[model samples]
Target: MPVIDFVTDEENLTMTVTAEFAAPVERVWAAYSDPRQLERFWGPPGWPATFTTWEHTPGGKAQYTMSGPRGEKSTGTWEFLAIDAPHRFEVLDAFANEDGTPMEGFPSMRMTFEFTPAGDSTRMSSTTYFDSLEALEQTVAMGAIEGTKMAMAQIDAVLQDLRDYAQGKGTRVELLDDTHVRITRLIDGPRDLVWRAHHDPDLVRQWMLGPDGWEMTECIAATEVGQSYRNSWAPVGDTPGEPFGFEGEVLLFDAPRRAVTTERMQGMPVETLNDLNLYEEDGATLVTVLIEYPDKETRDMILATGMADGMEASYARLESAVLTPER
Candidate 1:
């Protein structure tokens, strides 16, 4: 097991767990920074985690659900309070309802995670501070300590399998639920540039074209909440396919980190929520988009249209035509 010390102090109303990993600090940090790596081991052995939302910066929030063996499920949320990259971070951890609101009767805790270099390895100390002794006792009674140990035990493998989790995999998609899908692509550029590429009309027109023989005819990007944005595409010359377009109104906009929009095909009533998040680690940015469709049929129809392959083509073009040239 990676956990070497598990201590619960009722006097201080705190529980601290210390674990050692056979990897460098950067590698260990990446395991937690990337939601894909985190979901693999965040839950105990039987309950696997699925992070629906991940915003790693300070003042951001992350939401995840853990599915149990017997169809049971638990939801949780983390509100980031502080972040010191590759070293320490703090979050307000709490039980959450299905809609992501804090669950009543469950106490929230201030959890701090610190990573330090130890010889050829890294030492991670996680400390959870409760508001009251009753709160600490309540959480401990709910298998928090044992569950945490089991969860940390699974991280060693994630830290070791670096290639499987990182870039060179191209754009990938995950079915989060019947109506929700997640798409991820790791871009070889900084987060700021990648965010700008999605918003700047000139940069967007250069890479957002999905495939060869296609051209972006209109590029109107929304810069603030409630503003509408439209993008249209047309085949070049005699290339097959009709002109298509999408229009959306921005619901939330956090530059260089996240954006949420309501998207729909032109003149179509069916709409989907598109959530875009960007995270930078080790000079590269990971782009994650969570799309919520109207229903299963719509989700399947979109996937059947080779959405992932088209996204891969656009991301490839982005690297070649925009990022590479800038570098």
Candidate 2:
């Protein structure tokens, strides 16, 4: 087994990183040359990435979007300089605007990837060259090297796991926009358990509030799509407060699947979206909740308000309710 290593030369504005994989040269080559296979394990951990466009020929390009952490969308074009099938490939990479137009302030860099067969395994090396030392310094400050290494490690792990399973990984969650709160885990429990925890009036009273004495005064769930639901909450601390609330229509509801969609319409009145998807995995059910916002600004605001932390707490409470044995 070969270890991963990084060599940087700030004066030359260049960095070279190398790693060895236990897999055959063919396997590692396919992972890089094929876009479809690349998407399965291309991103860093905790973020989902989608490859929008990819062409392997010289002067061809590739674009992708990565979300999670902070919902940043980036695009880049690749000009293939050399292509030696299953051996080596080189290209020029640059940042582009969302509309696919080249942007200022970003350095166009040359990236070359070489794959050499070392016995039954493969030795992989990547060399990145910048236009100038100033550009390199700026990229270093942006943590480009560290971020790239992290992403590559994730790809390696994902590839090894897929080989072990003899199958690919499952679909991932993509960040729609920038938001303050990160939804860490989407768990699935029994339909009755989920419904009782989210819809039952009594269950709502306990875990939805915080330490400052908050209460859910009203929670209404309508079965129909166009029908609406409203939740009104108020603080009950030493300082009396007015109600803070949200109201939205039921976009979807399927009891068997235990899925629901709610749109927020009051208090903050911001358009907050929530989706719940439930299905069976193994012997137990899994539930995935997706939340989207219009942009990154509001997402940051929600994060600053401790909403993400509050959400994790709420999920923990739900877990407790299901895991506790029934009398």
Alpha-carbon TM-score of each model against the true structure:
0.59, 0.53
lDDT of 1 by residue, 175-282 (tens): 755877768888889999999999999999999999789999999989988899999999999999999999989877778877878899998899998878776766
TM-score of 2: 0.53
Model 1 whole-model lDDT (C-alpha atoms): 0.87
Per-candidate Cα lDDT values, in order, are 0.87, 0.63
Alpha-carbon shift of residue 148 in model 2 (angstroms): 1.5
Worst 10 residues of 2 by lDDT: 162-171
Model 1 quality (TM-score): 0.59
Q: Which candidate is the best by lDDT?
A: 1
Model 1 clash pairs are none
Q: For residues 99-176, what per-residue lDDT tens digits would candidate 2 score against the true structure? A: 767779998899999988889778999989998988888878877766566566545433454323221222233343
Task: List residue ranges in candidate 1 displaced over 4 A.
Answer: 1-164
